[model samples]
Target: MPTSDAVLDPAVAARLTRDAAGLVAAVVQQHDTGEVLMLGWMDDEALRRTLTEGRVTFWSRSRQEYWRKGDTSGHAQFVRSVALDCDGDALLVRVEQVGAACHTGDRTCFEAGDLGAVVGAGA
Candidate 1:
């Protein structure tokens, strides 16, 4: 759901901060559960395709291709809503995910990482 205040157009793309490789960070979240599934890179075309196609599409930095989530695997992510951060450097994509968002076959990419090591056990 795009709001009138946030337009997904060429102007918006121009305002965003992309790296030298012309990519911005996109964080994908589970719509209902509010679970952050994964982070992917997105170029302007990928962002446009995500809005227009009604599915989450990403610029694969490793493969150097456009990968629509669940395109190759059955675990697809349908766009429930999208929000651009105030800085225009990142996007929060709330999706109705169909299956695992991780390549490792886990429900989410963050599950494998040890949060305790970074955040500390007591803190």
Candidate 2:
């Protein structure tokens, strides 16, 4: 796990610990279009991969591997910026998406509702 040499502020560290098992949720979004691309999980490795590779990579809970979002589907998400929520248990990854963000041939995993309706539904 990555640690800062600087002392961690308790408030910040507390906020970052909602995922007690060392995992967090990452929401991928299109940087230019502002479209939500996909949702995935991240372990420390996944986070490292995204930061290091400059692409969206996730830890598949079911597949139990590090999954690069578009490795197979060709719907690559090129990361733009990563933001952590106030709680820090979740992340928002803005990216420059290449193709369809969904495996089902859709633009985004969140193609159902408008932003107003799904604000708190957990991205």
In order, candidate lDDTs are: 0.87, 0.76
Look at candidate 2 and give me any clashing residue pairs: none
31-115: candidate 2 lDDT, tens digit per residue: 7777777888887667767876898878777877777987898878887898888777898999998888877888887776666
Once superposed on the true structure, which residue ranges of model 2 sit more than 4 Å away at CA? 1-15, 18-20, 112-123
Those runs of model 1 whose alpha carbons end farther than 4 Å from true positions after fitting are 1-8, 117-123
Clashes of each: 0, 0
Model 1 lDDT per residue over 14-85, tens place: 778888888889999999999999999988888888988899989888888888999889999999987888
In model 1, the clashing pairs are none
Point to the candidate with the largest TM-score.
1
- Top lDDT: which candidate number? 1
Q: What's the residue-level lDDT of 108 in candidate 1?
A: 94
